[model samples]
Target: MKILTLNFLTCARKACKATNAAFPLHPRDAELEIVETDLNPLFIRNILPRIEWDALREICVELGLPTLPDAAPEPAALFAEPIVPADTMQDADEGAEKQPTQLLQDLHRLLLETTIATGKLVCGNCGHEYAVKEGIANFLLPSHLV
Candidate 1:
């Protein structure tokens, strides 16, 4: 499963629905794979506001990945230094081309290129383990857990 997906997922158990600890399921014995993917700066920038920075940082630490910044970066920081200010330019001939900064590329690699080939995502609140295989996460809850 992609790290990006974790932002929206939580413990499947109903009782853990409103719990603060249910989010950003902890990955255990994770087998990571690098799957190169196209970078989409616009999408990342748009979704930045919704990302849980602390949760993501925790996940990174648990997975033994590189640590992220303490705070989420502002959208404007994702782009390269433009010779011309964005507001003063047009889409085509009038503007300096906008490029993604190194940080943006790093975020793309961390969030999209990285995948879990096989692992268990354990919920902190309910102590439930969700299996991930072949990069697909199984969020199904058994009857008792449901």
Candidate 2:
């Protein structure tokens, strides 16, 4: 599953849902894979507000992925500043549109390209482990857990 999915997932157990620790499920023995995808800056910009910055950082630390910034970047930072110099005044329209930046590419790698091929996602609150295999996570709780 994508890291984006993991960031939003909490403990399956209803009891743990209300707890602070349950939101960022801890991955154990994760087999990570890189699945390349086209970067969608508009999509990223739209989804930025919904992403939990701290939880994403914590998950990255757990998976030994590259560290994210201390704080999530502002939406405006996703686009490169249009560099229309006064010297090269020709084709001003070409530089007028915003372009995706390195930060956006980095975010695309983390949120969309990275995947957990196999792992166990353990809840911080209840210690219930959700098995992940073949990039699919089993979130169905047994009757005992339900």
Candidate 3:
């Protein structure tokens, strides 16, 4: 499986610029990295709810990646599983009606901090496989793929 891990610093910088938001923490170039994994059904099932499916699909298509089923039954089935941490659970209990800050933190960790150390990361929209090698992503695409 191909693995693709993005330089989080680069992504955040681009995002900040695009949204006109101040850069958080003045991150150095390539300092904070965001890695995308070529995950199996199981891993995808675990991550579906946390992910923005439309955005994921768009990225995948942009990268010429393989497409998944339009309806992910496995992910739906696994939605009830507690992907959040114990602290998040406590926070939820404390404020039943309010948004759980811990939950958001956990989501951030899963989506941004985790590294795609192994496996492939295909773009859902583009069907491109951004292979990861030695902690670097090979985003290069042939003319046809592009």
Query: Per-residue lDDT for 144 in model 1?
Result: 75
> Per-residue lDDT tens digits of candidate 2, residues 1-146?
99999877999888999999898999999999999998888998888889999999989999999888899999889998777777766877776768888898899889999999999999999999999999999999999889
> Which pairs of residues collide in model 2?
none
Once superposed on the true structure, which residue ranges of model 1 sit more than 4 Å away at CA? 82-95
Between candidates 1 and 3, the one scoring higher on lDDT is: 1
| lDDT of all predictions | 0.88, 0.91, 0.39
Q: Which lDDT tens digits does candidate 1 get at residues 35-136? A: 998889898888889899999999999999998989999888899765776677665654655788988898889888898999999999988999999999
- TM-score, one value per model: 0.89, 0.90, 0.30
Q: Which ten residues in a row have the lowest lDDT in candidate 3?
A: 20-29
lDDT, residue 9, model 3: 22
Name the TM-score of candidate 2. Answer: 0.90
lDDT of 3 at 1: 15
Candidate 1 weakest ten by summed lDDT: 88-97
Q: Predictions ranked by TM-score, top down?
A: 2, 1, 3
Model 1 scores a TM of 0.89
Best by TM-score: 2
The global Cα lDDT (0 to 1) of model 1 is: 0.88
